[model samples]
Target: MTRAPATRELRAEPVGSLSVWQGAALYVGAVLGTGVIALPALACRAAGPASLLAWLGLVLLSVPLAATFAALGARYPDGGGVSTYVRHAFGARAAAVVGWCFYFAVPAGAPAAGTFAGAYVATALGGGRRTVLGTAAVLLILVAVANGFGLRVSGRAQLALAVLLVTLLLTAVVTALPHARLRNLHPFAPHGWSAIGSAAMLLVWSFAGWEAITHLAADFRRPARDLPRATAMAVTVVGVLYLAVAATGVLVLGPADGTSDAPLAELLALGVGGTVHVPAAAAALLLTLGTMNAYFAGAARLGAALGRDGALPAWLDRGGGVGEVPRRSLAVVTGLSGLALAATAVTGVGPQPLVLLTTGSFVTVYALGTAAALRLLPRGGLPHRCAFLALVAVAALLVMTGWYLLWPLVITASALGYLRRRQRRDPGRGVITS
Candidate 1:
């Protein structure tokens, strides 16, 4: 077997200490957020009962993707997650491109998610769009504060919220299951398998954040041993929860009724009592908030890691006191997220469009990361062959789900330009490595 270089020998510094459970919580919290709550209704509308097929397809694709990430994390337990993995497997230029893509996706996703959370809160509070905007602002500020303190503090809150969200969702599912009408499943493929595939593309976004935990692999207690287990557990739990909630939404509301905006909330209101709607709305808000916090933590760290590597502004590398927060990077994240919120509010583009715009960029990152896994796999063996084939499949799926690849390409070109400028300033200075 070909052994990879030790993290310490490679001069990779550990930023914080995070146990397996905490890391798992971060992963689950990020992966299960607002998308899980919102997408089932849309998926049902898009594919009818056949949306279940989309869910299953996503699960199958996601498991191997998650496992590939876990294996990469085990081999390269360093910060910057996918970027570092890509750099180790490929080279600095490719890693730089991946870093930019991942970084952009974070802010791109923030506004839509924040808006969704805000909308849920507004409904719960009997307010309007203004209230939703206010809620979004408040959520951004809260997440920034929590993350600025450190991952440990933010991660604990995230874990608690994840548990609460899962419990509430599961309870709602169970209650609604008894009320399921058999007629709801008729005309399973209302549109066609093509539509199901399209819906599956959208649903896959809900599963995107599972790999975020790989960014903090060095922080794990025993990353090589625990990383895979934590990643698998997180993805499996989130997948099961997603399917359960989707089923509950279909069961109680029926295909026609459940196709509306807030299907889960509608189901809870019907299955339990009208009184449950308020709490369900509140749960949705909290779930989105948890996701925002989780992403904030991961994105800031990625920025700091990029800064450390001289791909971004160098000030971001400065660490916080106890929580391992890069204070400068946190500021950047807050500012960018705030800007995104403002832009979305002004333009009136909802979550779907925002998510669609960023999905291509995210898929590109996944493709590159998976390709890196293939390259880094133990050389000259069946393991390498299998890894290469899996990576190829992932790459093909990314291309098949074409939304907008140009955004990622533009961001990468900009990063490359910045890198070139820095290199010219100091010709002999070597690029930072994991």
Candidate 2:
């Protein structure tokens, strides 16, 4: 008698909640936040016109990396995205460390987003410390309130804001093209290729959140097949948008002209020749608000995942019964973020420090995740070889980029401390990988 074909095991029960579009929106909103608006100027400062090339390099590197995560999420569908994947491949303690590192990274992002929002508001209102801090506080509270309601509510708001911001950004880019000068292209690599690589470290951070959606894999209607596509689509759209805006910035304002505090706004002011500060400022305000909203939603989910995995206190894992909010987790996220914002404001350190710290942590996670994928590949299959090669490439980029390897030891030590505490508290508990 012929034997029946072997059945594949399902790792986790499907939550069966979020629609495809909702999933897509979450991916897009998470990736496009404050970084999209801020990076063009920052990259311009670092690499001049050659930053566009860096953006392109990041897009190429990120897509496969995102696909690798999506594949892991589809197979696992666990609470913590990268944490879950690492646990499955490496073991529970390893996963806990990953969770802790990600948890640490998530809160720092708050100050980055808040500061970006505050800066835009400062420009709009003619600048003041109190005004900037107050505006940031108000924006954070608004996003926190919305998140405390439900993911569906926050996701819808994200969709709307993302659409509006993209529309305005595209309009500005297209409108300014006619006024672009050719002289800007004369000295394309003013800072040399090394600057492009360094800036790529920062540029990759802007594109980092595409994998954030993987944390909610259980919510996807058909995660096994659709998650990868959604992730690829989100990364593609955001990458194209970033390139378009960066190209426009370089073309219109030239790399040198747009390197100031409010680069995009400055570019619009110059391009429009003193006739459009109001509209440009208004767009900047909206873009900043959108960024804050996206980060708030994405970061909270990450924290909640960490809590659910027992990397944090269990109280944060309690969802507000059906249709209600994750009030406890929301509080933790908001409180930590608020503390970071206050520290940033008092120390007068701009977003760069936090950006570097968080980005470093994230790249560590990315390198670890890719390494985990290589280990998890089957013994003999064409797909396995392909994945192994991809992971190798990812490893090279992580090394060549060289930011995470430089400063991740501190972050790793902190994560190890957290992991030890968790393990000591419950030695018998098998760390849930999914």
Candidate 3:
């Protein structure tokens, strides 16, 4: 033989390098977050003890909602996730707008998650706006850096965080259960049955991340087999934990629960005596960081996929290098988060707009996803039946969100207008970044 070239052993891509248990852990991390910390108080304010019913109702709704996304993930299995499904079911224009809504929502939502944790941290170390702001900034930077390495690193970290969070939550529930008074539940529906709907709107944020988890379906060793199983496991875990915390807020904290932002801290202090501020603050931070990391990781992958697919400007697509991190996408995410945080800190504006925008964007995504499932999934089957129910439920939830829908509407219109202008000038340009 004169001269021969040696073949390179290609490095395997590390996208879907996850087991079922790891997948379940990641789901738990993403789904159980800041909502567990502060939203209970808001729910309690809206429906008193009846907020427990709101929690249960959303969990029940999650059954079909989770199934809808899991089926789509198993069948489609793409990094674009809900956006890819929307593209398949609707068209590119709609998909682009929806994708933009989702990508941008992280910037808005991450700050809210940060503030939930930051408030507790500030209180623990003696309250100050500067402490809250600094704590949140540190949280954002830490999560972004953790995810910048790769999915495997993020997934393992998430699993550990989820375990720690579950342990803390369970400890709180057990410690407080003995102090729970049955009489606290007597005036359950003080706000009336209509209040249940209001509470459900507030509580919807808590039940969000199941759709987000579908982005990582491709990372599972056997996506179709494990995705549904993982989802079911996650739902059970999240539901039990959420119900336990809400019960503690109502039964143990009673009237004070509705007003306290740090309901879990209050419950623990009541049960143990003395300020358990440090432990409470640490728990809140861990809970928020876990959730933030999950979203940052998923959105980074999604942004790269969108860039590669021409849905977004190709300049943003830099994560797919055999076995590398989504650095470009993460930089974009961190930048947006930084700006949003700065604005909020300077303007003294509340995070309600950002929260509403995130909720509305995701709700739109849910509606479209369930609609796609109903259309594409095999008819006369259980999956199809669940999709049908989910579609109806998502539509009703959208209406319940009311004027909040306007935020996503404006975003969609702006996105469409930009795409149209770009197309008019370029004629055949699409968004592939190579």
Number of colliding residue pairs in each model: 0, 0, 2
Ranked candidates, highest TM-score first? 3, 1, 2
lDDT of 2 by residue, 35-113 (tens): 7657778887888888889888777766767777777778766546777667667766666666666666767776776
Better of 1 and 3 by TM-score: 3
Consecutive 10-residue window with the lowest summed lDDT within model 1: 1-10
Model 1 has an lDDT value of 0.75
Per-prediction CA RMSD (Å): 3.2, 4.5, 6.6
The global Cα lDDT (0 to 1) of model 3 is 0.81
Candidate models: Cα lDDT each: 0.75, 0.68, 0.81
lDDT of 3 by residue, 1-434 (tens): 11121122111233467777778887887888889988999889888999899898888888888888888887767677777776766667766776777788888888888888988998899667788888889999999889887878888888888899999999889998999999999897999988988888878878888888777777777788888888889989998999899988899988888989899899778777788999999999989998898788778877877787677677777864324577898889889999989988999766555666688888887887887677667789888899999889888889888998887888788878867777777767853211
Give the per-residue Cα lDDT of candidate 1 at 202: 72
Give the candidate order by descending lDDT: 3, 1, 2
As for candidate 2, its clashing pairs are none
Each prediction's TM-score against the native? 0.91, 0.88, 0.93
Give the Å shift of residue 366 in candidate 3: 0.8
Off-target runs (Cα >4 Å) in candidate 2 are: 1-15, 270-275, 285-295, 320-325, 377-390, 393-397, 400-407
| Model 1 TM-score on a 0 to 1 scale | 0.91
Q: Name the 10 consecutive residues with the lowest summed lDDT in model 2.
A: 1-10
